[model samples]
Target: MRFIYRLVFALSLTLGVSAQSFAQGLIRDAEAEIMMERYADPLIQAAGLNPDSVDLYLIGDMEFNAFVTGGQNIFMHTGAIVIADQPIEIKGVLAHEIGHIDGAHLARFGDASRGALATMAMTVGLGLAAALAGEGGAGAAIMASGSQFATLDMLRYTRAQEAAADQAAANYLEATGQSGRGLVATFERFRYQEVMSRQRQMEYFRSHPLSADRIGALRRSVDNSPYVDVTDTPEEVDELRRVQAKIIGFMVPPAQTFNRYPESDTSVPARYARSVAYFKRGDLDHARAELQTLMDEEPENPFFRELEGQMLYESGFIAESIAPYERAVELMPDSPLLRIGLATSLIAAGSTEQLESAKAHLRFALTEEPENSLGWYQLSIAHQALGEQALAELATAERAFSVGNNVEAYQFATRAHESLESGTPAWVRAAELKAVAQPSPDEIREWNRNQRQRQPLAPSRGLR
Candidate 1:
């Protein structure tokens, strides 16, 4: 797991932070992503939505949250992943969110998730609980005072809407041969929140409006389900535990991780957590030892190899990290994360041949994940090292755009567009980025259709 925590969780009570800050708080892990997909694909298909069409993100927020926003996108907080005790619990949460997506519930939140402004969807969800989420004092609210209460008012769902989503979630679980018991159990856990003040309850409860009647409706569905007794397979359980262990290892303090997964607990998940804890504390020797044992036990697991590479590269053993990174990419060639890791290691090697190889790997990885700002930044490094100034400028522009820094992106893109031969593909790309960073007054775009007033149309996007 590449652990990253930025200003994503409840972002502070202050206002005026740029949309770019929202772009910076996404995390990527091959194992965690695949685990999410394995659970989501079936439920999405069951809900009559194309699994491929839906986008899932892992946000670096510590507060437990999972929400559906613009374009069938699901943003899940790492806190939510750690909070789920059972595999089915998270799936149930996703099923419920998908139900909201299926019903287009966000339409009521107002037509707010338009281009470059898609980051605002996150703000929309967070703003609903600003009054309570801030926890006290300056934590009182996250958005500006002017629009905060209006957002809260608009986001409050009707009881009927909540019930309909619950019904739909139940039906989808049944369709996918999943038990509704998990869904019912999840609701039951949150039922106590209904009686609490909104300021004292979870952000989810405030927005979803849970009630005893809602729990009863789901319980009834579960009681009547033919698959009520179905439980997660052993593989599913192991995967979930490992993923939970990874997030905990990254987010929790070393002492807390050690206490949670004591040394006597010799399970893979326990070792994984301990290794991450050690890594966090800069205990490279112990981290490597724990990981070596894991690699020996499961030589074919790509994530272990990726982590090994991460440990070595991040700790400045760039040369030694290359083999493991290459092996990880070999094990999971389709994973853009692994590929980017390999590219980073290759770039750090600093040899002419290694630099060329790094460029190739980055080209392929960026094709797979163009929104990865780090990859674009590295690509710029590789290009500059190779004396490809125009390409480096283009890569710089791309990196800037990926992070929602239009001013910098426009500056670099203009330079690239002027330097490159006009009408060439690279020049055209530079032109495109330039246009996005600062579209002229004459540009025609429906993306501008929903703006409160005239402003630059940021690309309607988010990175994960």
Candidate 2:
């Protein structure tokens, strides 16, 4: 398996200092964003939140999970994407996490806690408590000791918050015209897995604590909803699911995934999945062939196009990769990943003529998603290519800090600072932006506070 350990969790807290100080990997593929936006738009609209304001992250892990830290950022485990049979399931999971943010559960906890130390204590204690709660065979012994911590109450409260988030998810799905069935279905699927293993059962029971009655309640709510017919499914959702599958599946061992769906139509994605396997196995020719076949079948599939372009680029076919990447941008104009690939390929091909076009594409991509670190990075390179050192420095600084490349960020920030004519607004802004590259004590506190804002509300103690 092509595993990526320590995939940094999404931290979006508004601390006295910026979490931007930490390095967060950039997964800014045009195809990934396009997929994310498809599901994100509907969920945000349903929850009455601005789609543009929310940032979605795909964590490189095999665990079937999704969660939001104190920040409002939504995180999806790559495993969650690879394992899901359909795109709606991923949406169901994201919508549920969004429910936690919209419900302000974390904010409520912060308000209830007396201070930062107490909040940290509660956070750590709650994690331990949840883990202990999952120790089914040893539940009695664990709980006996677990109750000693003050956060036990808080832990129970967190479970309640999860339930409330569940209820809110149902409402969001129904309001948005998507079926609450997906949510219920996902829950039931987890519930089944919980039943199969004492460990999983304990984990779900501790964190979720849903009973038959609760599941039935959700079912009833879905059954009674009047807005069942209201939702318009975006074609992008399916495409995103396929893209998710391809990317994630490619990351995993082909045997594990192909074993489950040996001859399914989903095999196309599985083949793409195996292509990654081939690449990892150092069979570049086979990998290229597999991706090429996929591209041939779905010529307009930008994700496949991007992959083909990347394969060609990596295989010393820089010139050959350019056309596919250009076509990829034509297919998804707003994709930063494709633009980055195109720019990188252009630079590799040493085409000064394409430099202007590449810069234009990067700029357009940055405008669409300012936090796209790769776009800014590519923009800097493109600027450097055009003999614009000052602009390159500025773009590089912004790119560095936004995605948590503190060292490079600091270097770029300093370069940008030195390149500027003193006392100009550009210099001042660059300096301010650079400050965020390395988070200080105050920034951490502010980030913690921001994270608390997305937390779900604690369930009433008297309810269960």
Candidate 2 TM-score to native: 0.70
> Candidate 1's residue-wise lDDT over 98-139, tens digit each?
988999887756554233235454454344233222332222
lDDT of 2 at 88: 60
**Which ten-residue region of model 2 has the weakest summed lDDT?**
10-19
* Collision count for each candidate, in order: 4, 21
**TM-scores of the models, in the given order?**
0.81, 0.70
lDDT of each: 0.73, 0.60
Clashes of 2: 21
Residues 1-464 of candidate 2 have per-residue lDDT tens digits of 01110121112110000112111121334455556676668777788888756667654445565655455666565667666665666777788888877887656665444254255334433332232223322322332243322232333226567777777887887776676776677777767653555444432244346566667877788778786434336564456545755654444555664564354544575677667656555577877887777888888777677776766776788899899889888888765556767877787676678878778877776666576555676778778888989879888777656544455565677788888888998788778777767655564554455445535464322201
